[model samples]
Target chain A: MTREKIIQLVNQIFIEQFEIEPDQLTPEKRIFEDLALDSLDIVDLVTGLQQKFSIPLRENKDILEIRTLNDIYVLFEKLAAEHPDIVAKLNKEP
Target chain B: MKPRIAITGAGIISALGNSRQEVYQKLLEDECPTRERDDWADQMYGTYQPFAAAVDLPVETAKTISRHFRRSMGNAALYATLAARDAVAESGLSKEALQSGRVGCIISSTVGSPGEIYASAMAVLRNELQDLSSCQFFKIVSHSSAFNVANFFGICGVQLSPCSACASALQSIGLAYEQIKLGHQDAIVAGGSDETTPIVLESFRFLNALAKNPDWSPSELSRPFAEDRCGLVCGDGAGIFVVEEWSHAQARQATILAEICGYATNCNGSQISQSDGASIAQCMRQALKDANLNPEDIDYVSAHATSTPSGDREEASAIREIFGDTVPVSSLKGHLGHTLGASGGLESAIILEMAKNDTIIPTKNLTRIAEDCAGLDHVTSSRPKRLRTVLKNCIAFGGVNATIIYRLADF
Candidate 1:
């Protein structure tokens, strides 16, 4: 719902699925180069993100522009603005 | 002339134990691993009995594989990878030798991940396809075990995954023998792996093939040819071997465990569920022909009898037809239940140990042979024997019959 929550959810996918440690979650960290995730792993990451955020992202072309951890958070923020209903639904989750 | 192939090493994880030595020890001690667990297949499938065989302990050896590389694996692949890793270790194959581009991997599972396959399908029904993980698809892919093993060791040679149900491992080893004998590869890691699920038991139960003889002694619950035998008890495990070209093994001074003398596989194409003795006999005869050996040369016949009435009877007849009634015939299923894809490879490892020790283990619960299965010399007890040549037979659900001949490496 919020920017920090979006960052937390994306960070959870990496920490849980990729076994990355918390210290590795700096927003400036490059996803592919620094995190060393491969193409298939990226697919996994996308699926993980979709499941965590409860959104359909397969058609979201902007995901291609994502280059760093901060980019992932910014993408979610942009998605929140675009899909207010999804963010509002999450905001109501209490 | 075809090149000789040597089974340099083998590894197995079975209900009997995690290591070959433990499995052999149990066989020698006449132990049975099947149990009436509360969580056995019957709990979910509501089959007649709760008796099923499973690996008794965690696969500690498989845990050594790093998690990153293991992310794509399922239970079947883990069993296979551990078995392959042990075989390579016992064979003293260096990492360089494995990655030499001349070593292939042939591993199999009937369906890659039976539980995952069903679960992913259920996810579709629930309109929750997005919930599937990134590694979920990889687990259920048909070649999961084979590709996982190859990737685990960085073996880049020919990779094949045979899916012939119970015949998979026999066919896998047979294919490896073909490849190395034909000079296509210097060596091949060959085997099969499978982990049982309630779904696996349900499939067999649907076919009326799960053992219902709950009153029998736990040790006798899966008797192959005993008159009171009911049906197979599903089991899980894996077996793997390092089969190398004879000349190459000798050049490297590797300890050859056994010689892959011959192999043959065929489909009768007529019978889908029942065992076809005529076709099985043809396969065995073909294997003997390839080995340039007569029926009398085989000291034993390891039958693919899964304790089902018709399966045991027909396989007995086939052995009698090919090697006559005197060849010591036995089914290891009585000990570990039916291991499906892993049986042929696991049993091959068993017989290799038998040949090494100059003794042969017998069918565990065979008290009295069924009348129709009477002619063959069914080994009813473990005893010292002049072991050498062994003919391994597998008859699968899809009318596939495979036979592989293994002999002592003394030659």
Candidate 2:
């Protein structure tokens, strides 16, 4: 998927799941400090993103590396680039 | 006798209504709010009259909870938090005072989060566990109601969650009363809450305890102590009370609604579902002894007749053996249906209102007394009587029996 599409999906996920507003989606905002999210919340967000993108984010180290919204978008883009299957799944229409 | 634990405030959320005035007025009007559950008929697959008293949740309560945490909260927790908020608001206690170490919280429920439990089990069975949220288990845990209330109020002292089926709420109240009367705490928020879910009804249906009479209207199906009483109609709601020490309430100039002067809890230890009349009588007598009063001292008794044939007969025999036919008796379940864990707290709150207004409410559909339930003054109609004291009884599935005595505050 394109970067713009990835950002849109991430924004929608955060807004709907965490009740976060669209305006609060700054790249510099810390997920834990600014968003007030704990480790358990991160797990839920990861699970939700995985289901949406159909990408496996299995490693705990990768989850730990994610700190900001920008980091999450970058991870999604990287996964889409590495896995053709995920790219094909994301491109499919509803 | 120990020092009296004063009930400074009481709150309820039920199909009947939320405020004391709403429920009390409905009781006096001889109205039953039960309705047909067409949705349940498809789910239960039985002709058993599927009637339930579902709560009309207040809009403010929904708006007050943030969306982020609201998803984690189950209906039981939401009902509990709303009822606790009302009770605390009425107590006139500041948030600082409520969060103080001198206060305690004791809430209970039969199954804390049945919705979450059902959803989680379904997901697992369907191999869709990957879609479940991380907080799913937290919501379904047995202590969700108590923990959610404590978190909502930032209560940090003496938190307890009783899980004794039908007697859960009364057990919580009795525990809170003991703690405060013994000077363990100055005040306590005590009560129970449950939500209307099909699983709750299904459990009773499995026990062959659901009311199923197609000829009778939904309101008339839950006829406690009546000869035609078939079985219990599952209902959902909550009742919360601010139980405080007498001196503490008096010192704060708070309005004392009633004083919980006596409490007794026992177990039949034989049949889990069927209550023994002998054990129930012992519980009542023990409560009277605890209050240092004779049976004649109680002006009214709130019977835990849940419209179940055997349960009503057992409780009625117990009451007759202890208090004879002089004491006016009625069961609020006739109006609210069987609220399970919340029944005792809900009934007790209404009983306090009855004492305050000098009016006794009769059983809603008790037109004819059953053969096994006769010989007692089963309040047939609302009447004005100077009630000084009221007795409340609760019998749960675990062979548990509990009784509490409340005396009116003259001042």
Candidate 3:
């Protein structure tokens, strides 16, 4: 999938999970400070991403390094590049 | 010698209002603030007469609190924390003092996080356990309010969560009084809170414990001792008080609002819903004995009249047997509805409010006293009367009874 599609997917997840408006999803917005997301919300976000992408998010320290929404888009892009089937999986409904 | 327990500050979040001034003004206006909860009633019991007295708490109010404390909180815990913050602020107690764990906290509720329980149950049915959050268990735990309060204030002292149905809040206060009077603790934050949920309301409605008056306004439906009284109207809120030892408060120059002179708690140990009037009367007499005062010394009586036919009559009989028909009595349920666990704490705080103006707030919709509740001189209208000593009563399911005596503070 293209990087733009990955950004759209992450935006869709935030809108669905946190009830955040799409217009508020700035790339530079800090998840914890700007979006008012707490540790609990972090757990939920990681779990949602893992289940939808079928990736082992907790296996690596990648989740801890993410502070901004852009970090999430970068992680998804890396995962898609590493596993070509991930792009095809994202296109299909679970 | 018993240590003197003084109430330094009281904070409340109820249908009436959050501030003392707002609640007092509404009480004087003598209007019932309950609104018809039509959807709740329809969905719960297919009835049209459901009414509730609810507090409006904006999410922004909790923005400043720590995320660790806020993440796991249910509605009851949130309300308790708000009241506790106000009480601590009003008492002039320093943050270091509270954080030292020298102060105790006792808060009560009927059930903890019913909404959370329902949500978890639905998830289980759908086999969606993977999406459940970590905070869900903490919110639904039985001690949610008590634990949340301690965590919020960083209090390391005695923590109690009493669940005695309607008497839960008063029992908490009574226990705090005992702890202070016995010199085990110097100060305590005590109160109770309950979130008005559809399931809780449905349970009460199914048991025929809620009012069903079709013609009366929302305010008039919860007439405590009126001849046409039907049943209680469920309400929600939190009431908290900063109770300190007299010497401790005096040393800090804290304003003493009222002195908790005596407290007594008892149980019938037999029926769950049925009340034993004799047992309740014994509880009151025991409290009077503990206070070392005669029946005549009490200037006012706060009755636990919840408007149910049997509950009101039984409590009125208990009052008549203890203080006879001479003492003036009233119930705040007419204005606030039956707040369940929060009833005792909220009403007790309002009694202190009444003491400020030396005015007795009459039962909101009591037009004619029921024959079963006739002997007591029920205050039907607001009147000015000097209230130096007051007796507060709380009775609940499981035949639990708690009586507390308070005297006007003097230095």
For model 3, how does the per-residue alpha-carbon lDDT over B149-231 read when each residue is reduced to its tens digit?
98888888899998888898899999999888877788889988887877877777878888887787787888998899989
Q: Residue-wise lDDT of candidate 2 within B96-148, one digit each (tens)?
A: 87788888889998887887888899898999888898888768887777888
- TM-score head-to-head 2 vs 3, winner: 2
Q: Give the distance in Å from residue B133's predicted Cα in candidate 1 to where it truly belongs.
A: 3.2
- Give residue B134's error in model 2 in angstroms: 2.2
True contacts kept of each: 0.64, 0.93, 0.43
| Model 3 CAPRI rating | acceptable
DockQ, every prediction: 0.51, 0.75, 0.37
- Model 1 reaches what TM-score against the true structure? 0.91
Tens digit per residue, CA lDDT, model 3, A23-43: 999999999998888887888
Q: Could you give candidate 1's per-residue lDDT for residues B274-390 as a string of tens digits?
A: 998889889999999999999999998888899999998888888878767878888889998999988889888888888878778899788988997888888999878887898
Which is better, 2 or 3, measured by DockQ? 2
**lDDT on C-alpha atoms for all candidate structures:** 0.86, 0.86, 0.85
Worst 10 residues of 3 chain B by lDDT: B41-50
Candidate 1 positional error at B49, Å: 5.0
Candidate 2 deviation (Cα RMSD): 2.0
DockQ of 2: 0.75
| Model 1 native-contact share | 0.64
Winner of 1 and 3 under TM-score: 1
Q: Clashing residue pairs, candidate 3?
A: none
